[model samples]
Target: MMFLVIAVISTSIISTSLLPNESSHIPFLNDDNFLDWKDQILLTLGCMDLDLALRVDEPPEPTNESFAAKKNAYDKWERSNRLSLMLIKSHISQSIRGSISLSDKVKNYMRAIEKKFVSSDKALASNLMNKLSGMKHNNSKSA
Candidate 1:
């Protein structure tokens, strides 16, 4: 079952490049929009069939006996990593870019962003809770 799923995903990634032009309307990320930008960027990566690059920590090393198969896997991994990095860099605003240099690997880049913005999941949850609690609800009926 796992092998079947991997095969289907591999096929999909290969065919993604051959499809007609599809615009990924990703929004640019700035200081004040990290959360929204993260959500949109994730969606864009999924649309491009490159979300796996961000999730994977490292690609499996090719075995010596299966050189050709290993080479193909390595090539695909490299392509996905490169595409992930490019997509992320393209969406970041100049001001934020000036503060930190992005890593070449997609996983590292994502970790860096998370570390800079939230530091920890607990902290992020607390921050969000505070924001939510501070909201002022105006009692007005709208059409």
Candidate 2:
């Protein structure tokens, strides 16, 4: 029983540490899954760069005004769009799990997302913004 308890504790620590931290405000681009899983991060990172360029030279850092302003309806709409993409991404990941090679999986997912973007609701733009912020793309020189 004592051995079981220690093992469980150690396992919990390792697993929890391995899971993504959603509240860290760090972008998802640098994650192993993001790095090896797909090219979607590149698109997301590019969009973020464009959005920030439009806003100003620098990307929007966490601030009171920006955070409060993003609470508007447009923000909600944007968030929804990102969520939809994430859902689709999750599905793609599950579908290809342990079957497709990493590069192929990424390529396939990217193609699928491009298609989905055309039909996606615009309200989810905020979510796109959120996804783009932390994305570190292999070819991206902007950040």
Candidate 3:
């Protein structure tokens, strides 16, 4: 009885400490909610201290003869990239998950979303303009 309780408590503590708390509750992304989802994803990444993974490109790989400093920098970037990829994959919608290849990197995932949703800032602005231009006011119903 006492042994069982101790085992359970120790397991709980170790498991909780090993995984990030923020990752357990992130919003899932879907096609219809890309704009809102992107904002939330960015916010969550920032909170996890992993925002740099998305903002910056991956560092170049170090050669065998490279200095310790360069190798260390590359290792840090690689870890960040892996973590960011995991987080991004975790939050992606099930419907879209099948489409994103397993080999896709974090930056590729982000760019895929941008390509599917935005393409470019200018393109998004143009799309919005076209929609607004098509709107018709029902002046007969209200002032």
Candidate 4:
């Protein structure tokens, strides 16, 4: 699922080629945009017809006695899982990329990404609370 970090030209002041097409305008995952990025990533994957991994659990690996339907399901899932991973990683910010351990499965990868976001959200709320604890509403003073 590892794709070389290559290419440039699109978002922010620096270029952004996160999605397959620059025109897709899917938000890249960054320190501040997990919520937005999450929605976009899901929608984008669905639009690309590659959300099979997200939609269903990985099917059991086909074996010598496996039925044709089971084999097909496994193949479909494997392809979707692989492409989903590539799409997901490509949308992540390079700076935050290293913090996440790579996963062969898209569901697992998404779970890791969500865990990071939840932790960051908690930290932000904690920081805000800490700041609030030190503040007072003196009607005469500016906030």
Instruction: Provide the TM-score for each candidate, comma-separated.
Output: 0.61, 0.22, 0.62, 0.78
Query: At residue 13, what lDDT does model 4 achieve?
Result: 29
State the local distance difference test value for candidate 2. Answer: 0.43
TM-score of 2: 0.22
Over 1-143, each residue of candidate 3 has an lDDT whose tens digit, in order, gives: 99999999998886456446745445788766777777766766666566676777777889999999989878877777788788778888888877655654677778876676654556778989999999998778664
Cα lDDT of model 1 by residue, 1-143, tens digit: 99999999998776566443344446787756788889877877776677777776566767777679777877777788898888788898887766665578888887788777765556778989999999998999899
Output the lDDT of residue 17, model 3. Answer: 62
| Alpha carbon lDDT at 13, candidate 1 | 78
Question: Ten-residue segment with the worst summed lDDT in candidate 2?
Answer: 50-59
- Estimate the lDDT of model 1: 0.76
**Cα-based lDDT at residue 1, candidate 4:** 19
Q: Which stretches of candidate 3 lie over 4 Å from their true place?
A: 1-25, 101-103, 119-143
Candidate 1 stretches greater than 4 Å from native: 1-24, 60-66, 119-143
**Native-referenced Cα lDDT, model 3:** 0.74
- Highest lDDT among the candidates is held by which one? 4
> Which residue segments of model 2 deviate by more than 4 Å?
1-12, 24-104, 122-143
Query: Model 4: per-residue lDDT, tens digit, 89-143?
Result: 9999898888997899999999999999899999999999999999988789666
By lDDT, the candidates rank as 4, 1, 3, 2
Candidate number with greatest TM-score: 4
